[model samples]
Target: MNLKIVVTNGINNLIKEDYIYSTDLDFILLKFISNDWGDLCNEDKKFQNELLKNPNSKYEYRFMGVYLINNIKVWIISEYNYSIKSLIMTILLPEEY
Candidate 1:
């Protein structure tokens, strides 16, 4: 998708501390990119879709997805960063939000 992805130190440490396989996280991110939005409710899905409609909105909007990674619930947020002029996605646990 040619997007810039980042991770938080909290999640980074969890990945290492819990021994979560990278492949599993990669697969979850794939689902996020595909708009699976795994565990999001109907209202949340609608909000995500609304943001997607704003490719030209004055303010940058974000697309968020929640999914299970290695049996742990996680959130993947993708947003357009006006400063960088690119899509930025972040992988983090709910607490990290």
Candidate 2:
């Protein structure tokens, strides 16, 4: 069975706060919604644009989920020290189960 992990802005923020990761994007896109999976895409346009534009600090995005109480929220996590993108990918793509 595939296990879905629930990630949230709070967790990401905490990671950054603890200095576990220095880079923190401004926005994240929530994509998936499942009690098991939680949130997925959480990146925003401006943050994405900055990631794409900059070459020095290459940014990478990953599908993540966050659990709130019993509900799950998905989000796209953006990782960059400075810069982001302007376009939202999941918005353009067709929804899949």
Candidate 3:
């Protein structure tokens, strides 16, 4: 599986440190400072659903509650992750958060 990785803008100022979110179908590799990594991981799914509903919304990074990867549901933190080469695979957004 091949996942499309998109680099958002707001993240540039918010996080000066380097981080990456790579996806390959069902696998997502998040590379960031171990400390900041945990905060955005398990956010409320309700927030993610609302943000993704509009495919064209201006919202860049927030909280991607729980999503599907290889048929498994997992938490996705938007902040601290956005490098292409570091990407591993595609990230599947769940129908209902």
Clash count of each predicted structure: 0, 38, 10
Task: Compose the digit string of candidate 2's lDDT tens values, residues 1-97.
Answer: 1222334455455565673232222233222321122232345434444444655432344323333321323234323323334322231111222
Model 2 misses residue 13 by how many Å?
Answer: 22
Point out where model 2 deviates above 4 Å: 1-43, 59-72, 78-97
Best by TM-score: 1
4-94 per-residue lDDT for model 1 (tens digits): 8898886788777975666777988888877778899999987877766765532466677887766788888887776777788998888
Q: Candidate 3 on 8-93: residue-level lDDT in tens?
A: 34323222343323342223334321112222434543454455577543235454433343344444444323464232222333
Mind sharing the TM-score for model 1? 0.80
User: Given candidate 1, what's the lDDT at residue 82?
Assistant: 69
State in Å the error of residue 89, model 1: 0.1
Give the poorly placed runs of model 1, Cα more than 4 Å off: 50-60
TM-score of each: 0.80, 0.21, 0.25
Which residue pairs clash within candidate 1? Answer: none
Return the candidate ranking by TM-score, descending: 1, 3, 2
